[model samples]
Target: MNYTLRTALQGLWHDKWLNLLCTLTIATSLFLVSLASVAYINIKTISAKLPDRFSITVFLNEDLEEERIKAIISQVQKHKSVKKLKYISREQGLADLRLSLGDADYVLEGIEGNPLPPSLEIGVTRRAVSGDGVGRLVRD
Candidate 1:
């Protein structure tokens, strides 16, 4: 056993550069594998949370009458999967755009009028986002 140990040590010393290269290669490969695993896990976690944030935006014609808009809202509210429904007027949409734009809101000043259309923002239950519930709601 002593002789075997001595011979192994001598061999290692003779091929020090080769042994060092092999060790570095193995360590780098392990590090990359761990990094990939962490990234995959984080991506999966983020994707799972997406359903909670899922929403649908339905744009309405600029000429739609108030009664017609109310009727549409009532119909959309009848759906069981709908968690919330918000109607945004053209003015409100512009304000929201300005808020989102922050310092760049001055760029919108060049536009003659509120080009943004009135729309319905619909939020669905988490279960609805997981399957065909959103599709059925859209079709209706």
Candidate 2:
């Protein structure tokens, strides 16, 4: 084993530049790929384990009045498993979109006005995010 190690080291030193370059390149690529994979797994685990982080957004008819939106939210809030609800007004939604767009002037320029209306953003309690529970809320 010592002889073999000595011979391998001598051969590596013969092409030091090429060996070093290949070793560093492989190491860097492996590090980046491993890091990305770890980050992806962490993100997936986070999303899967915490279902309550997602909001169940129900969009009503565009012509629907704000009063109906409020009433729907009130009904949803009555549910024992509902954590919170948000009614996003059209203007507020538009502002959110603009903020997300980062001043991309042409992003919504073609759109004349805010088409999105006040919708119910319902946050389910931790235990109420099962498939059946979500289905019940959707059916309501």
Q: Write the per-residue lDDT of candidate 1 for residues 97-118, one digit (tens) a residue.
A: 9999999999998899999999
What's the count of clashing pairs in each model shown? 0, 0
TM-score leader: 1
Please report how far candidate 2 places residue 132 from its true position, in Å.
1.3
**CA lDDT of each prediction against the hidden true structure:** 0.94, 0.83
Per-prediction TM-score to the true structure, in the order listed: 0.78, 0.61
The digit string of per-residue lDDT tens for model 2 on 15-86 reads: 999999999999999999999999999999998878858678777677877677677778888988789988
lDDT score at residue 45, model 2, on the 0-100 scale: 92
Pairs clashing in candidate 1? none
